[model samples]
Target: MNYLLIENDKCVGVCDYEPNVGNDNIQVITYSGNIPQERLIYVDGKVADMNNYTFINGKYVKKTKAIENLLNTNDEAKHYLNDTDWLVIRHRDQLALGQTTSLTNEQYLDLLTKRQAARERVVEYGE
Candidate 1:
């Protein structure tokens, strides 16, 4: 059986066996033949399901991580901008030299448009 080492009503960590008695705050809850994942709440001597739940006022409540998702989207947008920045620079360099770019004008314009949109998303969604 795996042991969940709880401290101050929170599952601080897991242990393979009951630890040597010392700290009173470190309570041990036994899991019968199962290993629970992190962020699972132990309430009323039972483990809650693996979901976006938070312990509030001695109970678990479902929560949505919208800001986290928005931040992730912003990060993805920033990455896209970084990945395609060279293409925009190359287009400008070729334009200044009056040389034919590898990409057509339409393609270059599309790239610019997409890059602008990515920047907008980063500004709107990022921290």
Candidate 2:
């Protein structure tokens, strides 16, 4: 999900890079559409600017982000905030409704047994 990000002509930075083993600095990497190494800029521990990146119009931009911030969002700010307790059912029959998720081992087994029973039907014979 690496995107070529640019700030302007003054400075350019490629966030897409590999970390150097010893230094905190990111190794300026060259990939398809990557800026020339000499043209890239970095200051302190971060890429100070990102305006010189080469990109085309209408290209969807993306970036590789640290995983730390992924789970930091609250339920409301999150995209799909499902209730931890309620089961989501598409229909209303025994088989129509699905079990609430997060089942334990025993619960899962019980669900399987119930599912088997729900799928069965009584048969009658007439004289």
Candidate 3:
């Protein structure tokens, strides 16, 4: 399945690959450019191309269903200082869903800009 990279504002390849966790059920995943499999984020369920990737701060873990909502939001991009922070605290007892690396705010903004340009081009061409 294809997933949207909210940070990069581009189409990223995604798959339902499982971690070494032996869960038997496939976890939906998002694969961004050069982002190692171990470093990508996995949330339960699937997302359409319209959904977005977000960086959430360390504050919202215990809030039930917060992660799901974060992924589905339109304009807001949540973030944590480091990717590991979310993994460690959120997925501690559970099997490691996947791996992720830190993406700086500047890097993320650049991605959005690119996405906007691409959108503009599509509109111009009437695609």
Q: Tens digits of per-residue lDDT for model 1 on 1-127?
A: 7777776556777778877648576777888755555665566677665465644445555556864566577889999999998998998999899998978989998998998888888744111
- List residue ranges in candidate 2 displaced over 4 A: 1-101, 122-127
Residue range 7-65, candidate 3, lDDT tens digits: 23222444445334244334334544454433343333323223234334421122336
lDDT of 2 by residue, 43-87 (tens): 333342233232224322222242122323322223222331132
List where candidate 1 sits over 4 angstroms from the true fold.
Answer: 1-64, 124-127
lDDT against true structure, model 1: 0.73
Prediction 2 global C-alpha lDDT: 0.36
Best candidate (score: lDDT): 1
Q: Give Cα distance to truth, residue 108, candidate 1, Å.
A: 0.8
The C-alpha RMSD in Å for every predicted model, in order, reads: 7.2, 18.8, 22.0
lDDT of 3 at 70: 41
Cα lDDT of all candidates, in order? Answer: 0.73, 0.36, 0.38
- Comparing 2 with 3 on lDDT, the higher-scoring candidate is 3
Error of 2 at 124 (Å): 12
